[model samples]
Target: MSTATQVPELSVRVRDRLARRHPGALIGELTVLPGGHSGLTYSVTAGDHRYVVKAVPPGQRPVGRNDVLRQARVLGALAGAVEQVPVPGVVAVDETQPAWFAMDFAVGEAVEPVLDEPEVPAATARARMLEIASVLRRLHATDTRTPGLDAPEPLDAAGELERWSRTLHAVPPELRPGGEELLARLAADVPGGMPPVLLHGDFRLGNVLCDGERAVAVVDWEIWSVGDPRIDLGWFLLFADHRNFPQLGHAVPGLPSEAELLDAYLGDRPALPAMDWFRALGRMKMAAIMGHNLRRHREGKHHDPDQERLPPTIAAMIRTARDILG
Candidate 1:
């Protein structure tokens, strides 16, 4: 970090750290990344290596907004983590200045426009999907909760229902269709809840970093929380639940059938919903969340495309919900 070359435009702080890591580590082309709910992310390259720097916005860091802090904790605890899957590494984290840190970046596209061959193989997709299931099993099996991140919450059957209910209630009328009945059934029929496991607050295809058909790293932790293991299961169904749900399964291989995924998740915990019933709840939750966001954006508040998709997205959630509940 040459005081002389520390130019603000190039993420001067990140530039300084790279130089320190390798002495030969030289900062090169800087790229800006968006789609994150909190703070900014940048891809910085030094020499032949690429790294991601995530930090709190200067002065925008709130008391509870400790993403930079939580990342450091998780990455450090899982440091030297070697699973079939890839995970990010924490190189340097600075909590004080710039509210920043850097990590060894995994090499793969973070988001795919659609599930394609290179991205997913139908036969292998199922196996790899199971691999992903194993990863979740391991992450949740551990009792370690990060210090600064939100404290653990109830992961039982009923809690998941109430949680989604709160999210659904936030949505306005015109936006909410058949979501109520779907939610009620899910609430009333609480199955044997899974053991309290580490839940990725947001688990979906879009957040995965893939090296060919396998998930290299699960990115985007701005919403990471410790809660019911079922949340992750429910979340996965949002995208990969039904066999004929979306054309998303065609090009993507090895994807477990909706029944398979649910069985794998429930394991010995409890019986799962009938394939159709599980599919309905999965889609309903997705819609409820989108409806909430759509409501916010309609009022001229939230503007992310992902958020903007809420209104229409929930319609699909409702359609699928009705089909399942009908």
Candidate 2:
């Protein structure tokens, strides 16, 4: 059965668990939060308090440190470590079969839809971009040595290229050649190393929550790890770039250019010479991920109508990677 169809049952499970925790608290609404690719997320209301519960999709095996409990541990560590960029506090965790965890629901709308709104003023859009940049800067500045947070294995660009190369096989046959070409290019010209920092693995406008023009919280910690901070910066920059995915529509007006956002992220530090390489890698990585998701949809392993549009999107990203790498 598709994960979307399982939402009602999952909601019942969450409600029953929360009811036990708070005793007399009433469990109110429980609705799915759309747009996440990895986990099934639901917004649950218990009495007057709202919480977000994320559960592993049924019949899906965990891959690459994406465990719900690991996410909870990261969020718990960040609660005491970083104040500038808000992250939800853990409310409860269930690591058994069909693993799930709940955390306080964060306020504000996702920056994704906000950026697409034409009514949003130019100045307001610019402020939102800057706010996100500031939050990322603060996140990278925080020490990764915080207790309870496990130090991830050192990131190897070559190994990553190999891993994604295998994942590319799952893509539609039409896209496999381009995927292989991108992987070969990345493997051959892997950029030299830089110091690693705590990376919000899927950092982008879509992952941030904005209250008007102010960024209030950075959510979705399932992919959190220690890696080249530029990996995060590159992903955010590509997502903000209009040319990368024209299917997503025109770039938002007044949003900071990539150079400006990079400056904001770097602050007093010298500009990264390998930023372009990282950006190219980010495009390739995202393309491979989309390709994999499309495969799942085609195989009936997952269900989402939106996955229908991913082929052209993945193709566009592959073309972007080629241009950037050239």
Candidate 3:
């Protein structure tokens, strides 16, 4: 059956599970939401409320990004935080039979493909980016023992490198020329002593919901972990470097520069270790991610035409990482 015809059937499946969690409520249509890179998402309504539901596709192992419960745990913890971190509020969850959770549907505009939005004035975009940096700083300050995070063992700089290495080693050698050399350099001089905090994993304008000039909420917690804050800061800063994404655009008109972002994130707080290694590690991680996705695209496991254009970008990331490491 065509995808259009199948959505309703799939919606019914999710609705049934949601009904089990929120018994007696009259649930509405579970319309499939677009643009989730991992896990299944839907816009659902029950009684007078609306929600966004995330679930692992049926019969698929609920591991990695597909683990909706894990994402929910973070959201649930942040929801009750003494210092509010802008995030969705969890409403209900069902762990049995195709694990799924519902969060209050965030109401705001999505500023994804951040660089591609020319209509949004550069000042507005830059302001929004600065706002996001402040929010990230708040999240980093949140207690890691916030109940649902499981008293996490934070990943140090070395652990961060090893985590992405697994993905790097899985790809074709040709796709990542200086991959091993980069990994070795990163491993040799692992920066230490930064206390781990709640990391957004993927922190960028695209992952947030914005209302006017403000970043109202940060969404998508699939890879959230306890790690050196720079891991998130470095990754977030990389987006401002147009060289990393040649396919996106040449000039970032209004987006905050990397230095500006770092300054905003650091504020008056004492500086941690130099971010060069972390920056290099971020690029390496990006290259590995693009390489893995490119491999999957070619193998027809995940067919996205965009992945076809990533080879040059991947090469550029590795090259840039080397330059940063120097």
Candidate 4:
């Protein structure tokens, strides 16, 4: 079903489910929050409380993406776990009937606009990048032995290559060849062992909410996993690199260069020796994901207008991956 038809039904379900947990509460002004390619997000008001409700679409069981319950569990696990980064508290969760959960609405704008602002000072932009690096360091440094936390399966270079290869094969036929070639190259040159750490699988400016220069919260945990910490670092670098997507990484003036950001992350540590390999792998992984979404859009399984631009974006990502690999 399209978003136009889905919102009302989602509103009714949210109201009913929330009312059960909070008697005498009334929901008001439920509006759709935009910008995400997966999952349905709504801003809802109940009595004096405001919340963000996220749900999987009706009749669609998204494999390996947008799992609302899994996100809730991670949010819950990180609630009081990290002192430096803010994670929203779980308000409620319902696994039945469309699979949705609610969390306190974070009160800040996404970090993207800040990075994109031309009038912002160069020093301010550099400081913001440093702050982001600091938060990521904190997240990677957190202990992952908490109870009830769903530990992600261990992943090495070959394993990650195999995982994305399956995703590539599942994409549209037109995109498969390039994906296969990238996977093969990555498999052949797979980097050796690096210590695994808890990863925020899709970390970037867009996933972070900032108040002024400080990151108040890091939202979206659907892809949280256990893997090489440098994967997150490489993904962040890829997002900022203009060679891959001009609209993303290099658009904002005053931002740190990829090397500078990596230096800040590395700090006193000797080196991130496998970073280049992970960077290329990050681009390939992103291309495979976009290709899968493009396939879904073609089959009418998902309906995001932005998916129209993904074909060229995926092509560009594949090209960049090849250049990096070479």
lDDT of 2 at 248: 56
- Per-residue error for 228 in candidate 1, Å, reads 2.2
13-71 per-residue lDDT for model 1 (tens digits): 67777888868656774566655666667778888888887777655653344457776
Q: Tens-digit lDDT track for model 3 on 18-122?
A: 677678999877777877788888788776778898888877999989989999999999988876789988877878767888888888866643455634666
Model 1 is weakest, by summed lDDT over 10 consecutive residues, at 1-10
Rank list by lDDT: 3, 2, 4, 1
The residue pairs that clash in candidate 3, if any, are none
- Alpha-carbon error at 76 in model 1, in Å? 1.9
Q: Candidate 3: worst 10 consecutive residues by lDDT?
A: 1-10
Candidate with the larger TM-score of 2 and 4: 2
Candidate 4, 275-309: lDDT as tens digits: 77888888888888888887888788988777776
User: What are the candidates' C-alpha RMSDs?
Assistant: 4.8, 3.8, 3.0, 4.1
**Where's the lowest-lDDT run of ten residues in candidate 4?**
111-120
Clash numbers, per candidate: 12, 0, 0, 1
* TM-score-superior candidate, 1 or 3: 3
lDDT of 1: 0.62
**Candidate 1 backbone clash number:** 12
Segments in model 4 whose C-alpha atoms lie over 4 Å from true places: 1-26, 60-63, 95-97, 111-126, 169-182, 246-250, 292-316
Best-fitting candidate, scored by TM-score: 3
Q: Provide the lDDT at 296 for model 1.
A: 76
- Please rank every candidate by TM-score, starting with the best: 3, 2, 4, 1
What is the overall TM-score of model 1 with all chains considered together?
A: 0.77
